[model samples]
Target chain A: MTAVSIDSAPKTAARRRERLASGRTYISAALIFIWCLIPFYWMIVTAFRDVGYTFDSTPFFTHVTWDNFNTVFSESLGNHFGRNLLNSLFVAGVTTVVALLFGVFAAYALSRLEFRFKFLVLGFVLGASMFPGVALVTPLFQLFTNIGWYGTYQALIIPNISFVLPLTVYTLTSFFREMPWELEESARIDGCTQGQAFRKVIMPLAAPAVFTTAILAFIASWNEFLIASQLSNDQTKTVTVAIAYFAGAQAHQEPYTAVMAAGTVVTIPLVILVLIFQRKIVAGLTAGAVK
Target chain B: MSTLAQPKRAPETPSPKTKKVQKEVGQDRAATSQGRWAFWLISPALVLLAVVIVYPVVNAIIMAFQKDQGLDPVTKVFVQGGPAGFDNFVHWLAQQCGSAACAPGTLGAQFWSAVGTTFFFTVVTVVLETVLGFWMAVIMARTFRGRSALRAAVLVPWAIPTAVTAKLWFFIFAFDGIANKLFGTAILWTGSEWPARWAIIISDVWKTTPFMALLILAGLQIIPAEVYEAAKVDGASAWQRFTQITLPLVKPALMVAVLFRVLDALRMYDLPAIMTQGSNGTTTLSILVVDQIRQGFNSAAALSTITFLIIFLVAFIFVRFLGANAVASATPKTTKGQEK
Candidate 1:
């Protein structure tokens, strides 16, 4: 008891010393917070500015307004913000569903199956992603053209899935591997079919990782710009291409309150999505990473 | 069904015939067990990947050959020998691809140089961000108040869409804009090449370092606290503890952070596309491809080929040589490599 007390004496003193040394942490944290907020603050300020305010230094304070939002939602864009929002939602939803469904299976295989050339398969997926998406536009353009798939949602969706597949596969695989081996062993000994056991137990348990990957795939697909531009000519433009170009040349010229409004419009949903999945994403990515 | 669901408790002293029958059934089930689990777990991702990745990649490789210009919607029919073979390669090399005859400075070697620029952008940004992020993660890990808020705030840049990020930088860095007003009388924020790219590089580093830091923080959590205590008790300095105690344990995490960032930086398109549009020397591989496709250049296919190669190389090398520990460590927590 006396020895334990002596140990505690030093530990308590050490903790006090450590706490004193950490005084700088609060200051650094505050600075980081301010730095992070500035960009978002700039974006919000620009979104509320009047037409010519953005060009001058006075834009920061000349009075914030709804004019940009008013223009974006009501008068400016050919397609209303609501409709573009729909387009973004639908695309994101589809991408999430497909990516998750496939991702789960690939993960299971990598986690469990001792299939031939499994490592090579992993490499192939990684390698495919390495293809600079922009440079492949030529081949994608040609491929889509020959098949008459150009300017279609399939054009965009198919390529998006392909690009994300390798990372998603690896991501989920790592997730599956992290799962307890004991559960699988117990299920096998209990005489449940392997498929039934996985369905009844494993899939349910992996839900968080699944949801995380789904959100990521959805966000990437939703925020995507280039593929949307090439795949859609006029009929099927996405929110990104819609807001960046077709909606306004004022991205450079004339009244950017509308453009700023459009920019704000374009960013909100994904931000919300990030918040929703932030913790899960952190869990999923870390699980996949920490082997 | 409920009876079937009951656990098959081992019979203590069963009749010989009943025992034989039970044992046969159990053996039969076990025989197919692994196979069933294997297929059940493996097929969904494998099939989807094959369809999405395997098919398109194979098809795209085939498409890179041939002058498929006849297939152009603007044109009525197919042109067979339409500069299909090495012509796209030659034209890309000669800088004749998007020269005024095509689209002026966006295609061919200009495009390849953009690929080179993309590599430059990715390497510089990844290196800087990784170092900064590691330091930040270390700082944040120390006990402090307002740390949660700071962590949340750091993510603010990442949460904002890239297009929005471009605008924020544009606001700060544009000629006659707040950047110049606040800092000096005259500066080229966008008109010149290096300054324009530097603006983007700075914004990217700001936007992404949080991601790296958060990831490293997650990795940092894995090291045993006892180890740090022991090191400290041994009179280790801050630098030694970081290098000796912290770094080796956190290396896998660091690699995962770096690999993810490198792959991401290589695929960078929207940032450059929105900001500089390959104007000046700010062009990256992605910008070049977009420009070529938009211009109807035959080399657009060739550009995609080269760009894909760069990203693929980075992904492969990072995953291959960097060790799986880094990838596995960072997977579910930091980068969203997780699947449901």
Candidate 2:
């Protein structure tokens, strides 16, 4: 009885320690969740609150209303929030499509075909990715002004493609490299040309990777602000620039509540995309970093 | 019968040799075609990059040397200035104007302070992010209920646009806002220097720590569970196991995350720009560059070139000494068809 008691005592102690540890884990997890989500929560709460309650000291939700959201879409004070949303969509969409088209071919060649200066190509891509956007601002601003392309969708889309291509190429290249070469070889052996094999066999298999790349590229181009802020004018402004310069109904007052509403409107779609594709996004992100 | 068989075998051997030559020739043709296809495939991206990145970079450098188009100090008429060798560089680097030190509040005088502020933000935020991210990564790596939910929640901030992030926090940090209400302190977060810096740091840390965590979590997931089991069986404490096993193993991912965050923080503009408008001593190098661009284009060019060099230098140091393997990490490990 004593021996059994002694053995069981330690096991119970260990189990108790584990339970305590798990409890601690739960507490920390909750803390992390709060830390991550509080600002977003604050934004949502303020978005729905009446503009009169903008300075209300209450921490939790109160004075819920749809007025601020209305303000976001309303044409009052020359605010073009609705139009800016469409502009952002158009720019991000076209940038994604074009970048994906160019990136797929480049990534394929970089990963599959043996060639000299492959690393040089990769180096250029990486270097361009790391190049400071601010450095390009003055030159691009001048160049766009010279060519009369300033504040156009093309102006936004062209630079966005350059910035996003690196990410697309890197993610797709890593993915394409890991794909099973035997499938392509078998297709070739079955009287398929190389292009035909890539099109029929490899592309269908590559759809998921391509989708991941597209989502990432779209998100990136959507979030771009530095160049867009300078290059975009009133008509061509993106959601980000629009929010930055959002006008209040009054001349002097800052539109805090209205801006929060705009912020929520802009963030919700991205947050939804992220939540839905959380696993794929994580996979795509780490593919470049942790490979 | 033996002689006839010998002649037949010789004919067959030569035919085999001829087939070998044909196969080699076919392989050469295939290789050339692949190369041609690759060149065509990659040129479009290359051309776009050249036009966008390469040309702008070269132009920025050239503009750094040429003076901004403005009125000559002596002549009242606005005239396009000529080459001003080393003048733009001196304006920022030496903080000198003509023969005297630039006055305070001038953009030239802000160069060193911007550099200092940029480095400060980079170091402080990265350190905070690494520690917090490591902790979060450890938690996320564990098997638990609602893990997926936690991961999705963590991504909320990261998914938010930086401009929006700036606005979201701007509301929070406002006077009589939730932050003040919760803390019961009415400190002006954006109206002062240190508080403004902390506000930027806090917002940055909140936004990017998840990124660091995700990267570190990937590294942690790659660790074998048996390693921890073995350590436990050998009576290693949790702390010891973490320091001895997990820390060393996670270093590669951790370093990469830190390097990226550092480089990112160095060029930080949006957060501070929107939050404080780069006032109250929150002027980062990029902010300073933009500010200078408004008043003096040539000097801003020089400032940006300097900024680029600084970032390049840091990246070089990281790759050279710290073994960050930035390039290798981006490259694929396996080539064609030796898949295990």
**TM-score to native of every candidate shown:** 0.83, 0.93
Per residue, candidate 1 scores C-alpha lDDT tens digits across A27-83 of: 666667777776676667777876656766663557678777777766444646666
Q: What is the lDDT for A20 in model 2?
A: 94
TM-score between model 1 and native: 0.83
Candidate 2 local lDDT, A173-291, one digit each (tens): 87887688778877876878879999999999999999999999999999989889988888899999888878887778778899999999999999999999999899887776775
Give the clashing pairs for model 2: none
What's the lDDT for residue A191 in model 2?
Answer: 77
CAPRI-style class, candidate 1 = acceptable
Q: Each prediction's DockQ?
A: 0.37, 0.54
Evaluate candidate 1 by giving its C-alpha RMSD to the native, one decimal: 6.1
Model 1 lDDT per residue over B1-340, tens place: 1112222543757899988787667655543554465566556666766676656556555555645454433454565544366656556656553222335543554755776788899889999998888878887776666666566566667766676677667767777667788777577777788888888899899888888888888889888888877887788998999899888888887887788788788878877777777677888777766776755545566656666776666666666776633433423333223322
For this target, which candidate reaches the highest lDDT against the unseen true structure? 2
